[model samples]
Target: MTEVFENSASFASDLDSKDELQSFRREFSIPQKNGKSVLYFTGNSLGLQPVRARKLVEEELAKWAQYGVDGHFEGGRPWFTYHEHAKKGLSVLVGARESEVVAMNNLTSNLHLMMVSFFRPTKSRFKIIMEAGAFPSDQYAVESQLKFHGLDPEQALIEISPREGEFTLRNKDILQVIEEHGNETALVLMSGIQYYTGQKFNIKAITEMAHQKGAVAGFDLAHAIGNIKMNLHDDQVDFAVWCSYKYLNSGPGGVSGVFVHERHGDNPGLPRFAGWWGHDQDSRFLMQKGFKPMPGADGWQLSNVNILGTAAHLAALNIVLDAGWQKLLDKSRNLTAYLQYLLADLGKTFNDFKVITPEKPDERGCQLSLFFYRNGREVFDFLTENGVVADWREHPLNETSERAGVIRIAPVPLYNTYQDVFQFSRLLKLALEKEHERITE
Candidate 1:
C-alpha cells in the first residue's frame, strides 16, 4: 500500500493533526540551522532540554548565592537532602521503590561505584559477562575494574559476539553462553539496550538465567532507562545504573541514577564506598566518629548531591511522570514502527539503504540504525548539510574505517513528531540518491 504521504506539507499537517504530545514540542528549545529547526533524530545521543530546566537550575543558583554554607542547612528548600526530591521520580522511571533509587555522579562514574560493592571476583569464580561491542566508556570501565581487582581483562571478561554476518545477538545464544560458563562467572553485566545496533536485550530472562547460575546480574541502562520500561526490582536484577542525558531529557552529562534490590537493604555487611552523604541524616549532623550508613541505594551515594543537576533531572522527570510513561511508550512503539515502515518503503524505492536494527519491535527501542551500502560518509555529510540531526556510531568491526559506520535515527516520543521522521526519511533518500549520482558520474 502506498504511504499516502504526498509532500512534506501533507506530512506536517498529519503531524499537526495527530500529535497527542504536541504541547511538549514547545517545552524544548530545539536547535536550528539556517533559520529553521533541524529535523532532529538524535535524541538517543542527547535529549532536548525541558523548558523548565533553566528555571530549576536558576533556583539552585539563587539558593547558593543567598546562602553558601547555610544552603546545606537553612537555605530556602535546604540543599542537605536535595537528592531526595529527585528520588521518587527517578524511581518511577526505573520501576524501583523510592528507597532503592538514588541520583549521583555521572554514568561511568556510577558504574565504577556500583562495581566497588557488587563486583567481588574470587579466585575460583572471577569472570564478568558483557557484549563484545559495548559502548567504549563501559568497556573501559569494566576493563579498569578487572584490572583494579588484579585480574587480566583477557582472563576475567567474557565478551559475547554475534555470529558472522549478523548485527544483533540471538537470545538463545546468549542463554547458552551463560549456561556454559555460569558457574565461573562472578557477574553478568550487560547493556539493557545495545548502543550500536539499537537492540534491546531481554533483561528479565538474562537476569533470571544469571541468577540461576549463581552469578550476580546487573545492567548498564544508559540507552534503556527512558526509552523502555525497566522494572528493576521485579526483574530481580542485583543492581543497575543509568544516565539521565539521553531519553531522560536531563541535558548533557546529567546526573545518573542507580537501583539496588530491596533484598540488600538490610544487609549492612555489604561493602560500599560511602561518605557523609550516605550516612544517617539524623546523626549526619551530629558529626559522629563511627561510620553509619543509610539503608538501600541512598546509602551508596559518595558525596552531597548536585543540586542544579538534580533539579534539572527533576524538571524533566516531572514531565515524564505527568505525561504517563505508558502513553509515551505506546506512542514510542507505534512511532518507531511507523518510522520503520517508511524506511522499508524507501528500501523498495532506493537500492542504497538497509536497516541494521532488529526487525522485531520488541527486540529494539525507538532508534533505528541504518547502513548505507556505498558513500555512507558522503550521505552523512549531506544529511548534516540538509539540516537533519542524526548520530553515527563508531564501528568496532573497522576502528580505522570511518566509512563503515551506520547512521542512528532516534525518533523520541516526547518531542519528535511523525513529520520529523517523515522528513528524515525523505532527506536520507535524497542524500543517498545524490551520492549515487555523484559516484556514477
Candidate 2:
C-alpha cells in the first residue's frame, strides 16, 4: 500500500480532511519553531499539553484558594476523591476493571512499590527477568529492588537479549528464557513496548509463561500505555505501571498509574510499603495506629495523590476516552505502517540508512528506531535545526560493543498527522544527502 503524502502543507490539508481526531490537535498547544509548527514525532518522549490542562489545574487552585482546609471535602469534586475522576477513563484505555486500576505515583516509584508487594524471592527461587535493553529508569529501579531485598542485582536479575545481528527481541526467544528461568525466577518484569526498539512484546503469552513457572508477571508500560490498547485484564498480568507523560498525552511530569489484577485485590496480606493514603477513609484521619490496607490497587498508594498532576492527566485522558482507544490504535497502526513505508522508501535512495524498528506493525509501536551508518549525530542535529523533533536511543553498552547509538523517530498518533511522517521522511533524506555532500568535500 503506497500512500502518497506529497508535502507537509498538502499533508496538513489531507490531515484536516479526514482526521476524526483533528479537533484533538487543537486541544493541545503545539510548540512553534522558526514560525512554523514543528513536525513533532516525539510524543514517545513528552506529550504536548492539552489546552484544557490549564483550566483543569486552575480548578484545583481555585478549590485550594477558596476552601483551604475544607478542600478535602467541601470543595466541588473534593480532593478526597480527586483520583477517582481519572480512574474510569484510564481503565477504559488499558482494559482493566475500575477497581483494579488507580492513579498514583510516578512510573519508576510505582514500579518500586509493585516490586515491594509482588517480587517475593526465596533463596532458591529468587531471580527476576527483564529485557537487556530496557529503559535505564527501569534498569535502575530493578537494581534497587534487588538490593532492597538483600540480593545482588547482577546475580539475581536475569537480562534477556536478541541474538547476534538482531535488532529486536523475538517472541519465542523471550518465552524460551522465561520457561528456562521460570523455576528460579521470583518475578518476570518487562516493558510492554521497548523504549529503544519500540517493539511491542507478546504480553499475553509472556504473562501466561511467567505464571506457568510459578512467577508473577508485571510490565513497565511507560512506552506502551497510550501508544497501543493494553488489555491488562485480558492479558492476565499480575500488575503493571505506566507514566502519563508519553503516549497518554499528559503534560511533562504528569502522575502515573498502576494496575493490580482483581485476583490480587483481596490479598490483604501482600507485603507493601504503605502510607496514610493507603489506609481506609473512615480511619484515615483518625490517626490509626496500624495500617489496615484498603482493597484493590488504591491500597498500594504511598502518598496523598497529586491533585494538580492528576488534573492535567484527566484533561489528556478525557480526550483519549472521547476518541475511543480502538480508533486511536487503528490510527497508530496505519500511521506507523505508513511511517515504516516512508522510511523504507527513503532507504531505497539513501544506502547508509537502516530502520532498526521491526518491519511488522504488530511487533512495534509508533516509533521507528533508525541507524545511520555515518554522521548520525550531525544528521540528528540537522533534523532538529530544520524543525523535526525526534530522539536518539543510546545502545546497551553490553550489546553495542563500542558502537554508537541510533536515532528514534516516534510519530505519535494523537497529535501527529500523515504530513508529519512525510515531512520527517523528506528531512531525513535531506539530512543524509547533506551529510554525504559534506563528507565528500
Return the TM-score for each candidate structure. 0.96, 0.95
Please name the candidate that would achieve the greatest lDDT relative to the true structure: 1
Candidate 2: the clashing residue pairs are none
Per-candidate alpha-carbon RMSD to the true structure: 2.2, 2.0
**Consecutive 10-residue window with the lowest summed lDDT within model 2:** 394-403
Runs off by more than 4 Å, candidate 2: 1-12, 398-403
Query: 90-171, model 2: which lDDT tens digit per residue?
Result: 8987889998999998898899889888998898899999999788899899898889889998789999988887878889
lDDT score of residue 190 within candidate 2: 93
lDDT of 2 at 292: 85
Candidate 1 C-alpha lDDT tens digits along 1-441: 123444454865575567677777788889999999998888898999899999988988988898888888775568888888887787888888999999998888889988888889999889999988999999999999999999999988998999997888999999999999999999999999998889999999999999999999999999998998788889898899989999999989899988899898557778888788888878987887877789888888889978888888989998988888888887788778878988887888787657888988789999899876555878899999999898766566766554677889899988888788888888888987887789789
